[model samples]
Structures are given as C-alpha cells and as structure tokens.
Target: MKLALRKIRLLVHLLHGMWVVATRFPKATVQQRDALNRAWSLRFLQLAGMRLVVHNDAARLDEGVLVVSNHISWIDIYVINAWRPTRFVSKAEVRQWPVVGWLAEQLGTVFLQREKRSDAKRIMHELADHLVAGHAICVFPEGTTSDGRELLPFHANLFQATVSASRPVQPICLYYEDAHGNQSTAPAYIDDLSLGESLDALLRGAPLTAHVYVCDPLAPGAERRVLAAEAQAAVQQALDRLQPVTARPAREAVGVQPPEPRVDVPHASHAGDAPAANGPLTQ
Candidate 1:
C-alpha cells in the first residue's frame, strides 16, 4: 500500500511538473529557467527517495564545455540536472517517450538520429555552435546504460564537437549507494529491462544516495579518440578512488576493443523514421 501510494504521488508530481514547465518555462529568462529546472529535479529525486551528493573539489564551471559521464540509468540525467541545468545530447528515440520526452525537449535536449549520416552531421554542427557560444552540452559517449558496476566503452563520435569548438571536456563520475553505504544495483537500467521495470525496482528499493563527482576537466586539442579515452580513464579512476574495495574494472579486461569512430553507426535500432528536410536544431 505504501509503495502504491508513492507511485501515485510520483505520477501526480510529474503531471504537475509538466504543467509548470509548459506555463512558466517559456516566459522565464535563462537563469530563471535554470533555477526552475534544478528545483524540479530536486523535488523529483526526493519523491523517488534518492539523495544527491555532489563531490566537487572546485565549483561547477559555468563556461561552455563538453560534459561526459558514465551512464547507469535514465535517472542520471536528473541527477546531473539537480546540480546544474545542462543541455543533453540524447538518442533521437528518447524524444518519442511519453511525458518525460516532451519535458526533455522543453529542457533543451538535443536529440540525435545516429542511423542517418546527415542527421549526425547536423547535430555535430549544432553542438559545436552551442559550445562555441559558451553553453555546456553533455553527451553519454557510452551510447547506452550500464550496471553501474563497470565502465563501458565510450564512443568517440561525439567527442568531435569538443574538438571542433576548442572547448574543454568535463568528466563526471556517477554511482549509487544505499543508506548503509553499500553499492546499490536497484538503479541499474541494463540489459533487456523495460523502463517500467527499472522504475519499479528503483522505487521499491531502500533510499539511495547518488554521487556525482566532478573530475578535472581535460583540455581540448587532441583527436576525438584520444579525448574519449582520456575522459573514460578519468571517470574510471574517480570511481576506483571512490570505492577502493569494489574492483570496478574497465570493459577492456574481457577483450573489448575501444569502438572505432563511428560516423554513421546506429546507436540503437528503431522502427521507421519519417523524412524531414531542414528541421531546426532544437526540437
């Protein structure tokens, strides 16, 4: 009964959030919109019984940079947003998700259709322009989620935007632990698990604490592949230092080579896409 009530309350809160975003977000200035986004994210985490702990030796940078992080669950987006509102580059299919999809669009997420070469090129140009204009744009170079126990291969394709704009790469490390401080797997949205099952698992588990550690930003100028590897190493090292006993190995230990620069590789297979000629960058 308590679980059911929690779900109901979350649903109501989501609907309320949508209304608030739809009503006030457009009229607000950039700073005000960012404030609203952070507040909403905090409340969302609270309702879901998750606590956010940010470990930043230095203050969060406000300048334009390419933000890269380890992806564990869809909840990672909100975890970062709660700290500072950021523009995210997500797969195009995410734009079609239910309520959250529309909210993502309103919040300034760039959706990428990886299968189409033209679409990828367009997104690359837009991302570069945003970074050049001093806006932070985040991309999950892993291109997918993981179990939060190991770091997956980071796709080097998106790293090109940072290089194009000559912007630094900000690497963030994210992980979850229970109240007792043990690693929590409840939030891992890996494998064939559906979104509903992932949410149910998170809501039914003990209260979780998510750590977002802002690591040292790597300076730009290197090739995309090099930048991707360096960022991945930085995140993995942070995760290692955070949990010394866990032995979180990189995926390479099992003979997985770093993925080549995939200019046209599809991130995920999606059904038919309607053709569009010359659409705006933000959708």
Candidate 2:
C-alpha cells in the first residue's frame, strides 16, 4: 500500500511537472530553465526513492563541454540533470514516449534518427553548433543502456562533434546501490523489461542511492576513436573504483586504482587541433 501510494504521488508530481514545462518553460530564460531542470530532477529522484551522491574530480563546466556517460535506465538522464542541467542527444523514438518524451523535447533534447544515414552528419553538426553556442551537450556514446554492471563498447561516431567544436569531453559514471550500501539492480531497465515494469520495480524497491562520478574530462583531439576509447576507460575505471572489494576481475586485471571513501559533495581534458568536419560519422 505504501509503495502504491508513493507511485501515485510520483505520477501526480510528474503530471504537474509536465504542466509547468508546457506552460512556463517556453517563456523562461536559459538560466531559469536550467534551475528548474535541476530542481525538478532532484525532486523526481527523491519521489522515485533514489538519493543522488556526486563525486566531482573536475570543475563543473558551465558550457562548451561534451558530456558522455554510460546509459543505464531512462532515469540516468534525470540523475545527471539533478547535478547539472545538460542538453542531451537521444534516439528519435524517445521523443515519442508519452509524457516523458514531450517533456524531454521541451527541455531541448536533440533526437536522432539512427536508421537514416543522412541524418548523422546533420545531427553531428547540430551538436557542434550547440557546443559552440556555449551549451553543455551530453551524449551516451555507448548508444544503449546496460545492466549497470558492465559497460558496452562506446560508439566513436558521436565524439566527432566535440572535436569539431573544440570542446572538452567529460565522462560520468552512474552506479546504483540500495540503502544498505550493496550494489542494486533495482533501477536498471534492461533486457526484456518494459519501462512500465521498470518503474514498478523501482517504486516497489527500497530507496536507492545513485553515485555520480564526474571523472576528469579529456581534451578534444583529431582522432575520434581514441577519444571514445579514453572516455570508455575513464568511465570503467570509475565504476571499478566504486566497488573495489569485489571489483569485476576483468577490469581489476587492467590495474584500476584502489577505492577511496565516498564524499557527499558534487561535482575534464585538453585538446589538440581539431580535424576538419568532413564526415563526422560513416554513413
């Protein structure tokens, strides 16, 4: 009964949020929008029974940054937004996902139609334009959500935008744990699970804590593949360090540093000459 009521409250909050976004966001300034995004994201997490804990290793860049992260659940977007409001690049399908989709569109998410080869160059250019205009743009280079236990290979195609814009690339790691401090999979939306099923699981589980590790940013370079590999490594290293005791052997074998104590408070790299943006992604 308690969990059901919590879910009900969350739904109400979400509807109210949608209404605010639809009505007031259009007239709000950029700063105002960012502020609302952060506040609303934090509240959404709270209502969804998740606590956000951030570990910052680099100064928060207000603009001209390409933020890359591992995708876990649909909630990962809001988890990062709670810390710093960022514009995102997502699959076009997400732009049609009911109320959530509408809210994401209103909040400046750029939707990409991956099936169309021609759209890649245009999307890359648009992302570069956003970065050049001093907006913090985030992309999930891994291209899909994982189980939050292991990272998938990152796609190098999107990194070209950062190179073109001469912006730094920042990697963030998101890990979920239960109230007792053990790693939790309650929030993961993976494999055959529908979003509705995932939400039901989350609302019914014990409160979770989301650890956001803001790893050091990497500098943009002419080589997008190298940039993608380095960003993936940074995120994997952060994940390994977060759970050192039982750190995944595959990652540990690679010599990840020892784990450190977690800190409550919050929150990148240098670049070489950028290559000309001839074709950002192979069609």
Candidate 3:
C-alpha cells in the first residue's frame, strides 16, 4: 500500500512538472525555470519517501554553477535534488534507459559520449549555455559510482565546461548508511547488482539514510585542474567526516589529489571554445 501511494504521488508530480514546463516553455526566464524545477524536485523527493540533510551556503539557490560530488547509489539523484534545483551531467546511455531516461530528459540533464572527445566538447558547450542561463549542473566526476567505502579519483577533463564558462563550482559529498547503522559499500553501484536485485535489497533492508554536504563554491579564476583537485579534496573531507572509522583510511587513500594541468595545449584559448550545436531536446 505504501509503495502504491509512492508511485501515485510520483506520477502526479511528474505530470504537474510536465504541464508547467509546457506552459512556461516559450516565455520562462532562467530564474523562473529554476524556481519551477526546484519546486518539482522537492515534490519528487517528498513522493520518493527519502529524507535529506543538506548543508548549503550559497547566496542564491538558483544561481548558475557547477556541482561536483562523489557518486554512490542511483538514489544519489534523489538525495541531491532534495537539497536544491539541479540537473545532471549523465552518460549518453542513460538517455536510453526506460523510465529513468525519460525522467532525465525532463530534468534537462546534460548527456555526453565519454569515449568520443569531440562529443564531450559539444556537451560541454551545451552545459555552458545552461549555466550561463542560470541553471545549476551536478557532475559525478568519479565517472562511475563507487562503494561508500572509498572515494574515486575524479576525471579532470570533466571540469572543462565549467572552467571555460568561468562559473563557480560547488563540491558536494554523499554517504549512505544501511539499517544496522553500518555503511554498505556493496550497493553503491547499480552495475554491480541487477536492477531487480538492487530493488529487492532495498525493499527487504532497513530504511537507508543519506547524508549530503555542500561546500563553498570555487572562485571563477581558479585553474581547472586546481579547481578539480580542490573540489575532490573537499568532497573527500566531507566523506571522511561522515564515514565509519574503519572505512576512513580506504576513503582517504583514493581521495583528491592535485591534477597536473595539460601543458601541451594553450589553456586560455581552449577554455571557451564553442562547439557545433545540436537540436535542443524538449524539456
């Protein structure tokens, strides 16, 4: 009965979100769009039956900025949304997933083909446009989800878009705990377990709790490599603070390291290069 009610609530929120997007599509300003997006996001979390603990220090919730965080379970999406209005930088494959794909598209997520460098450039350009237009973007720089036991090295290249746009980037950390009050690293990655298996585990398990902490946004003038490193370190610190004592060492081992900037290319010239635009997807 509880599950059915959750589904019904989710459907209603989605429907309302779609209607708002459709009606405001032509004339909505960036701030208005963000307001609507945040409203829908809050409703979505309410429907999902997840609790959120956020540490946000930003002057404005709707400001344009890049958010980098440690990736954990699929529920990380809901966890982050519970804090503020935001979109994600997801892999192209997510667009093909059944329900998730549709929802991601509706949320105006930035999609990329990581294997193709050029496609990444194009995606970065699109992301910059959204940022410039006052939208917040969340990126999981670990490139893949990890067990809550350890933080992964972030791909510095992912920072290209925000660096180019000269936008502020906020670092966030997420931690999930099982019912026993112990952290379970096994359920972090969706690929590690089949969708059914993952769902079953969650259903049979005690209610999980997620912790999110948002740090100060990096200044615009910081170097991309430096920015990435600093963001990684910030997230690691947050994770360390929340993680169990036994897991601390492993998480710290993989935590942030300063990335060496690529010296071959001229940094300034490549920073804001615009790529060929693609047809805009419907919101």
Question: Could you tell me which residue pairs clash in candidate 3?
Answer: none
Q: What is the TM-score of each candidate against the true structure?
A: 0.85, 0.89, 0.74
Q: Looking at candidate 2, what is the lDDT of residue 106?
A: 74
Worst 10 contiguous positions by lDDT, candidate 2: 272-281
Clashes per prediction? Answer: 0, 5, 0
Q: Which residue pairs collide, candidate 1? A: none
Over the stretch 158-228, how does candidate 1's per-residue lDDT look in tens digits? 88888899999999988888877777889888888877788899987759887887878998966999999
Runs in model 1 lying further than 4 Å from the true structure: 57-59, 247-283
The residue-by-residue lDDT of candidate 3 on 114-228, one tens digit each, is 7787897788788888788877888888887777667778877768777778788888887766667677553354554865555445444435555666666777654668878
Every model: Cα RMSD to truth: 10.0, 7.8, 10.8
User: Cα miss at 264, model 3 (Å)?
Assistant: 47
Local distance difference test values of all predictions, in order? 0.74, 0.76, 0.62
Native-to-model Cα distance after best TM-score fit, residue 173 in candidate 1, in Å: 0.5
How far in Å is the alpha carbon of 69 misplaced in model 2?
0.4
Provide the global lDDT of candidate 3 against the true structure: 0.62
